[model samples]
Target: MAKILMITGDFVEDYENMVPFQALLAMGHQVDAVCPGKGKNDSIATCIHDFEGHQTYTEKRGHNFTLNAEFDQVAASEYDALYLPGGRAPEYLRLDNKVLAIIKAFAASNKPIAAVCHGAQLLTAANVIEGKKISAYPACAPEVRQAGGEYVDLQMDEAITDGKFVTAPAWPAHPALLRQLVALL
Candidate 1:
């Protein structure tokens, strides 16, 4: 099993992230829930209650918890894959130099990097999407294209994998995206 690192922000799509996180654990991979620090407080708050609305979200609760490690604290060499869930968090995360560095490190390492919806924003910010074909929420297409990625308009059931990168549209695509990510593991 691969050692996976799941990165999030203050408020990611609560359900979309949990499914893949749980699937990785069920597949016997060791997963770490990493997030950026807002301040001195080490605990990262997530809308746990809101996440329960989805069936897949409920199953992923076992390993659901926060890690104190800021983006800069994460070591790229320790993880086999990086997973990003889409939401407003990506917009904020993209501005942090540390997060961008981590993103770039994962891309440089050629490790499996999975992103969904707005999470693609961070990928674009890291400048690693150049010449790559990926999928994201329709509203984010222009940004992806501007970043040099070919954005595909597809159903959530469809999973898009290009090289070491994998992407999906939104919450509905969680299952397919998780399955594809597990296959990579």
Candidate 2:
């Protein structure tokens, strides 16, 4: 079974973090979810981002997501793949040098990386998207472009796979993202 590392932080999208974690586990993969400044068993707050016919998605408080691993103890080489859950958390996690370094290590090893929604922000910040094609939330297209990446805008349920990288627009694309990730693994 593949050992997958999932990185998330406070305000991570509820479905993005939980669904994939459980889904991968069900597939016989071992998934370790971690967050910066958090230790094993520590929890992070989640937010539900729902599309309610408004101009933008609305946020609501969601369940507490517990971390099964410690971020500081993670070594990119120990994991076969990396998962980045999307939400407001990505906005800040992308700014962490340690987070960026972990991402770079994964990329350097040619390990698969799957990111959804704002999670693509980390790819941009790590400078690892250059010349790659990715699909992310529409709002993040500009960042992808600025990073020298071609952003393929997709609907909520769609995903794009380019080499070792797979990305989707949001939580709605979990099914597609997970499928592609499984194939890569």
Candidate 3:
């Protein structure tokens, strides 16, 4: 099994955060979910983002997700891989230098990094996806291109793995996403 680190924050997409965390745990992996300013036992607000015949996804309040690790205590060396869940959080998390640093560390070490939907926002801010091809939420494709990465627009169930990085369009792609991540591990 691998030691995995998942970075998330307030308003993280509900399924994106919860499913990967639990699925990895069920697979006998050691997972530590952390938020920038949160610590062990701390909780982050989550939201449900889903399509409902609207022009865009709808958001509704979801469960309060608990952190099992402290962000400040995270060291990229301690984990075999990294997971970044998408949502409103990445819109802000991308601005955290510390978060970007962690992402860079994983890339430098050639460890597998899995990001979904808006999670690519952090990857862009970290400048780790340049010249790589990946899949992400359709709305975020422009950011990927702007960051010098080729964006592969795909349905929610498809995933793309280019080198050590694996990505999917959105939460609905969890099955493929996790499978790719586990294979990397």
Candidate 4:
């Protein structure tokens, strides 16, 4: 079983993230949900809703994912794969230099890195999509093209695996994306 680490933050797509995680777990892979920090108030930490609209909680596997752990602590060489779920979270994660460094390490080490929706934005920031083919949310098409990646307009019918990178469009394509990710495991 592969040890898959999923990185997420606030405003992440609750359902999109869970489908793949559950599928991987069901396949006998060890999946860990690594997040930035504990949530406040009534907000849940390290959990999201599944596609069926049920709440799914994540098991804490690492200290809060910050600039330090993302870059200096967590080594891409230690994991079989990395997964990034899209939403407003990517918009902020892409700006963190450490996150970018970790992303670059994943690309450099040739580890499988899967992303969806705005999550592909991290690939753009890490400059890992150059000459690669990928798919993201429609709004990010120009950005993907600008980053030297071919952006396809297909739903996640199949995962676009360019080298060690796997990308999908959005929530509607979660099933296919999860299947592809599990196959990799």
How does each model score on lDDT? 0.79, 0.95, 0.95, 0.72
**Per-prediction TM-score to the true structure, in the order listed:** 0.84, 0.98, 0.98, 0.78
Tens digit per residue, CA lDDT, model 2, 1-185 = 99999999999999999999999999999999999999999999999999899999999999999999989999999999999999899999998999999999999999999999999999999999999999999999999999999999888899999999999999889889999999999
How far residue 85's Cα lies from its native spot in candidate 2, in Å, is 0.6
Measured by C-alpha RMSD in angstroms, how accurate is candidate 3?
A: 0.7
Using lDDT as the measure, what is the rank order of every candidate, best first?
2, 3, 1, 4
* Decoy 2 TM-score against native: 0.98
Q: Which residue pairs clash within candidate 2? A: none
Candidate 4, residue 136: the lDDT equals 88
Q: After superposition, how far is residue 178 of candidate 4 from its true place, in Å?
A: 2.2
Q: For model 1, where is the 10-residue window of minimal lDDT?
A: 56-65
Q: Write the per-residue lDDT of candidate 1 for residues 1-185, one digit (tens) a residue.
A: 79888788676666666777777778898877777764323544444322456654322222234553445568988999999888667899899888888889999999999998888999999999999998998879999999999998989678798898889988788778887877776
lDDT for 132 (candidate 4): 90
**Candidate 4 residue-wise lDDT, 1-185, digit = tens:** 89887777766665556667777878888766655443222232232423454453232222222221232346667888889988667888888877788788878888888998888998898899989988887778999999999998876455677777788887677777776766666
TM-score of 1: 0.84
Weakest ten-residue segment in model 4 by summed lDDT: 59-68
Which rank order by TM-score, best down to worst? 3, 2, 1, 4
- lDDT computed for candidate 1: 0.79
Model 2 misplacement above 4 A: none
